[model samples]
Target chain A: MASAERIGIRSDRDILLARQRGRELGRSVGFVATDLTLIATAISELARNIVLYAREGVIELRVVTEDSHRGLVIVARDHGPGIVDVNRAMQDGYSTSGGLGLGLPGVKRLMDGFEIHSRAGRGTTVQIAKWLRT
Target chain B: MDVPVLKQGPFLIATVQSALTDADLAQMRRLLIEQVGKFRSRGVIVDVTAVDVLDSYACRTLRDIAHMTGFRGAATVIVGIHPELAFTMVQLGLSLEGVATALDLEEGLAYLNARTRPTIARGNSPRNSAGPPRNGTHTRGKR
Candidate 1:
């Protein structure tokens, strides 16, 4: 079991770096090409949210196993204006940044396990994981 | 890095050589639209063969480029979306609605040529009158 990797997200460049790292981690966890793309895309959406709303954040990538099943986990954390309405944020086509509003929902759909913790004026944290299929 | 936009006859082709940041995509959009108007191009092809991920921002930028270029009287086609990327995009609900896509650069050019032929035939512009002949070779069958 290798240690987790953390990438600071402060700009658009960090978004790219985070996703690339997520893909590499997913590959090491035995994810296929399609699954790796899914993981990378999910990371991009999460990291972009940090850049767009928080202006700074960290993306933590880790490889885990449970009962012989291998998986990759991603945790995106930011200390910025948190979500006023978590449910609304989860809804499709509900964007506050004039975006497509598919970021959170899209990430949820891509990963097998999804969790979000946020507080207004405090920050937001999203944890997503994808398990490898045996 | 800036994506290189090459002028191919009456079209502009921008090839994305690697993973592009959001800023890079926005800049490319601006450049493509500017060059399309500057060169009076009839079509634009964005080749993303080397891009490994097409996230929401990238997808939206491509669609915006297509729409913006369309307003300038040039059609836009996105090419070289990997199979895995396409699947992931679909799952993410990034439909890329109203944006044309092809398998690769060749198919994109063919589609663009087929689409632009009718307007040229209608004598929209005398400059494009000497464009490629009306051959059936460029016609993509049943797609």
Candidate 2:
């Protein structure tokens, strides 16, 4: 049983580092290959979005376990022009920025539990969870 | 991600150096579509063999590249889709529809070579004759 955490430094490099942190932490928790892959994918998406949309942001990775079941929690927050249309962004073929607007919805589908909060001109925060054995 | 340039006959082959996740898909869309339109080439080979997973986002991106490249009068061949990833994509029931994929980079290059080499052999291609395709296992597709 192990526990660890990390914070993204609001830079492009930090996005990669955050994803690496997710893999490292997942391995520390003895996560199997499938679960580890899921965590890595989710973390990479969130981190990449932070760098792409916002000038900078932070990412938090935490391990979780319940009744011997283990998992991961990934939280990515960014200070950027918050999304004006959350619902539209979630649509598969819809993209305002025109770059493959699959960041949020894609990551949400990859992980087990997903949540988002954003306000215009304020900032955006996204949290994702991946179960260990799922 | 470290994408290495490999030369295969009349084609410029390059393996993707990172996972072809949603984020990467977004970037590649711009690079391969908008940017590639500015230049002319006989063909472009993108080896996604290094990728371990493929999702709707990544697949859609590849499809877009193929379409754009075709519009530009250049052929785009997506090579080296990992078997596991391929299975996952099929199982997920998400079809990319128009993207061409080979088993490995070599095979992909061969496919391109078969099409482009004839043109190059006639000195129509910019690259030289009697060359083979470049191969590298790069990029992630696990998302």
Candidate 3:
């Protein structure tokens, strides 16, 4: 397995970079075209959130294998003004940025596993994974 | 990268050559809206065949472009969304609600042509008699 790749996210350009890298990584893990799109879209949402809410963050991508299944893992970490209410943030159509409010919820729908940790002032971290289909 | 917006008769075609950042998209939106009014275009087509991903921001920007251009009496059509990208966009719950979409540039032009035909037939097109003649020859001849 290749070592994890890390992309620093600060602006909209970083969001695109992270998404491209995520798509490449997912493709290398044998993800189909549709699945790769999903992974890339999920990465875009996470990276954009970091840029919008945290100002700066890092997205880490890795390939993992467990037993017979191979998967891709993505971790987004940022130290910025974090979410005050995690539950509300997770809800669909709940955005504080005047957006469509589909960022977090959309990311959750795209990935197989999702986890987010945030504090009012401590920043935020989101980890998500997608397993390759046999 | 800057998207090239070409004037096609009473329509404007903005072809996105690659993945555009948020700022680039915003700029494209402004450019499209401005050109639509300046040229008195009856329709606008955004060709995204080269774009590999259309995220929420991109989708929102496209929607805005459509809405703003509509105010100028021009229809907006987005074309060349990949099949995979479409699937993922739906899964992400992202939608271009008011924006028109088609399979490719040709289809987008076809849609726009059909959409604007009624206005042209009614002689309600923004093009005035003092402007270039409305003959069919000038449609594809202009930049």
User: Which lDDT value does model 2 have at A35?
Assistant: 59
lDDT of 2 at B128: 26
| TM-score per model (chain B) | 0.83, 0.68, 0.82
For A10-42, candidate 3 gives per-residue lDDT tens digits of: 999999899888888888889988888889888
All candidates: TM-score of chain A:
0.96, 0.87, 0.95
In model 2 chain B, the worst 10-residue window by lDDT is B134-143
- Residue A127 accuracy (lDDT) in model 2: 82
Ranking by TM-score: 1, 3, 2
Arrange candidates by lDDT, descending: 1, 3, 2
Stretches of candidate 2 above 4 Å error? B17-41, B51-73, B83-97, B117-143
- DockQ of all models, two decimals each: 0.86, 0.08, 0.73
Each model's total of backbone clashes: 0, 8, 0
> Which candidate leads the pack in lDDT?
1
| Top-scoring candidate (DockQ) | 1
As a TM-score, model 2 comes out at 0.69
TM-score: the better of candidates 1 and 2: 1
Better of 2 and 3 by DockQ: 3
Write candidate 3's Cα lDDT for B13-117 as tens digits: 999998899999999999999999799999999998898888898999999999999998899999999898888889899899988999998999899988887
